[model samples]
Structure formats: structure tokens, C-alpha cells
Target: MSFKEASKQRGLYLATVARNLRLSPHFVRLTVQGEDLERLPRHGYDQWFRLCLPTGDGPVDLNALPDQFGLAGYLKFKSSGLAQRVAVRNYTVRQHRPEVGEVDIDFVAHGDRGVAGPWAQRAQVGDQLALIDQGRGFSPAGESDFQLLVGDESAQPAILGILRDLPRAAQGLALIEVPEAADAQPVEAPEGFEVRWIDRSQSPARPGQAALAELRGLSLPDPPAVSAYLAGEQALVTGGRRHLVAAGWPKSKIEFVGYWRAGGAT
Candidate 1:
């Protein structure tokens, strides 16, 4: 579904960094707070938002941008000088406490490689930023089925959110790949659900390769209604989904997202 359609609440908001901490060797956690968060809706599963950072040693004028995100809004932003003076990216909502007007975002930090990563690494308290709520991407239909959630570190927060919000009786398997074993964190799910952490340090290539390989080799229970959610590098999502479809899983039952393209920021 489109972001507009999926979002329960939509708007442009200004926020300030409240806290920043290193969550692991590869992840950085930032707590952002703003009164605007009081109006942000929480759908409880895979909720995400668009972020905009000021560009080139100048402060961003968030009010100069469009209130919504779309082709028309994008065109406006593109034609305006704001586009050149702002850096934009997408991120998941790891935690939200609207009562206190705060939201937490987990960023996959790859040193100085990308815009958001580097910015997050140096982010300081009281730094202002912009966000546009895009709502959630994963919302499984009610049915009798075992769920499969898989992705690299970029997808970890979303997968963990899904696990935490899943029904107590839900049965599923979540495979998450990270740069190092230390990047793995606690994930809460049903008693019958299983969560596996795949360390990419064991391999020489990028992160998603290990997860994709595992999915290809895994054997599922017989005759179970399966709902699968896959995200991360483009190839992993495409390849894993292809494997599932080839194994007779219905396309409608699978939610696959390419969270980022390989070799560049996405």
C-alpha cells in the first residue's frame, strides 16, 4: 500500500534529539522528542517515517517543504532550494512514548559511508530534525498460519517491533542478519516463535547474504499456512521471495520489501 494509505496520521513535524547511544557495534540509537509526537499515531507494527537532515552546515527550514510526501510534493521539494539543503532518509520507529512526546529511532551505522549513518554517529542532544509519518508496511491478515520474518540489520527494528506486537499464541520464525554477533539484541515473541541471529562477520560479503542462504536451506513444517515477511538488501528480498514462491507459497501471503539497494544508500 502507498504511504498515504497506510498511515493513520500524516504530517510534517519538527523534533530535537534527546539522547544518542551506541546500541551495538553496528547500530546507534537516538531518542527524539517533540510536542508534535503527541499527534503521531502508533499502529504497533513496523511503523516508519521519513527523516530529513539539514545540509551543508546550515539549518533546515522544515516549514519550506511540503506537508505530505508524494510525486507532487517531491516535485515541489525538488524544485525548491530546500531540496539541496536537506538530506532525506527513511527509518523505523523503534519505540514511541507519546505521553511523554518522544520517539526512538535505531540507525544502522556504517561508519562514515552514508549520510544518515554519519549524521547519527555525531548526532547531539538538542539537534533539530524533520520527520513525516509514513505509518507501517507489515500488517498480516488474520488467518491460521506460521509466520516467517527475515532481514538484515536495517530490518531488525521492524522485525523486533512485529515480534513484540504479535499475538501471544502466534507461531513464527524470525531470522535477522547483522554485522557482528554483538549486534544481536533481545526479541520478544510467542512461546512457539523462534528468532535466529545471523552474523555477517562470518562471511566476507555484505550482510544479507547469510540470511538469504539460510532461508534457502530451511525446511518448514508440513502443510502449515505460512505468512512470510522479508526485507533488507534488494537481492535478499527478491531471492528469498523467489525461493518461497517456488516452494508453492502464495504471493499474496508474502510481504517482501527491499529495504535498501546494495552498494549505496537507499
Candidate 2:
């Protein structure tokens, strides 16, 4: 399309669900498809997406989605709007393969309490999702002497993405504080990098908890520059970012994302 048309594009694209995958006992994968993915961005650790799915009855329908007041489309969709509108959840863009117009998002399943979690638990072929326009990347830019990535399942997808994109010679350390050993998934990283999974499945990840404490005690090598990216619960992000800054990582170099706030909207 012309640059004008592309530049005018607003809001996220509406992508239909192609399939679902149960990555592990605790997580699910929603594979979505759309033509908008043709010129998708190659965002590493910084990418995020909103996961919107049907909340009501049988075969999913796109015309039924809530959209701006357009009488014609409304008549077409509402008449057959058999699905109930539910909540919209945010998830990381784990992998986007534009070659096939498909993208994969990993969801942590915690039962019906979470809308997307349980929905994905029973997602079928041809399911529909109103995917919003893509979000900006989360990967650290420029050169860094050393970097750090930390989070739980909430951060795994982005963590894995970051690790996958890191140069094979890149140097860094990953302290993936996850729920138990089962939550620890195999990740690809540089030879000099070390990955440590802190098991805490028995309880929710608390603020200034075990992982943060451990991180504080460790000594890091000083270099020309260092950066860190953190995503997960709010308190952790706040404290983790503060600690890293105090530890010498330039605040500007740290990208801490509070994926979800505790007891409030994500």
C-alpha cells in the first residue's frame, strides 16, 4: 500500500485465532493470523500485545466485536453477535513469523480467574481474537558492557525473545525468578551467560523477596556500560529498578515494565 495509507493506520489490527498450544502444564499459546503481520516489526525483548478473545458462545465471529458506530457493519455483526464480550489481557509477542502470517503468544494459565488463561485452556481451531496494533519493542538498544534480565512466567516470553536475539558472543546474566522448577523453561543464551531460575511456585512473587535479596548480594563486573530489562508485578519492577540503579546500572539504560499491577488493572 501507499505510504499515506500505511501512515494513517490507527488502532491495532484485528487478527483471527488460528490455533492454540499448551506449552506446559502452566502456560498456553495462542497462535493468531492476520494480513497486517506482513510487515511486522522484529522486536526482541521489548514487544508486548493485547490478547482479546471471545467470551461467549459457539463459533467465534469478528463482525461481533465492539467497534466504532458504523451502522452498516453493526447491523451485519450485531445481528449475529452470538458471543459475549469479556476482558482484554496483555501478553508478550513471543514469536512473530511473518513468512506465514502467524504470531505466537504464551499465556500463563491460572484457571477461570484469568479471562485469557482459561479461555486458552479450551481454545479450538478457528477461534477469533481482536488483536490490537502492535506495541513498541522492549529490547535494550545500543551497546552495553553487560546486561541483566529478570522475571517470572509473566516475563518468560520476553526473556526468551531477548535471549534468542542476543548475539552468541553477548555477555549477560539472567535471574529468572519463576514458580517452582517446572516453570523454568529451556532458554537460548550466549556461552558466557548464566541462567538461574529461582523457585517460588508455592507462593506469589512477593516484593523485595528472595530473588531481589539474592540479586543484591551478588557482585557484578564493571564495564563501560550496563543495562537491564525487567517485567512482571509492579512492586518487583519498582524495587528491582531502584536496586539496579543503585548498583550502578544507569537508570537510562534500564527498561523496567510493570506488566501488571497488583490488585488493580494490568
Predicted structure with the largest TM-score when compared to the true one: 1
Q: Candidate 2 at 52: error in angstroms?
A: 2.6
Q: What TM-scores do the predictions have?
A: 0.94, 0.78
Relative to the true structure, how large is the alpha-carbon lDDT of every model?
0.85, 0.67
List where candidate 2 sits over 4 angstroms from the true fold: 1-11, 56-86, 141-144, 202-208
Q: Write the per-residue lDDT of candidate 1 for residues 101-214, one digit (tens) a residue.
A: 899999999778778889999999998888887778887645568899999999999999999888888888999999999998887788878999998888857668899999
What pairs collide in candidate 2?
Answer: 12-132, 12-133, 46-137, 46-138, 46-139
lDDT of 2 by residue, 108-183 (tens): 7766765777787888777677754445445545554688887766788888888887777777888777656776
- Candidate 2, number of clashes: 5
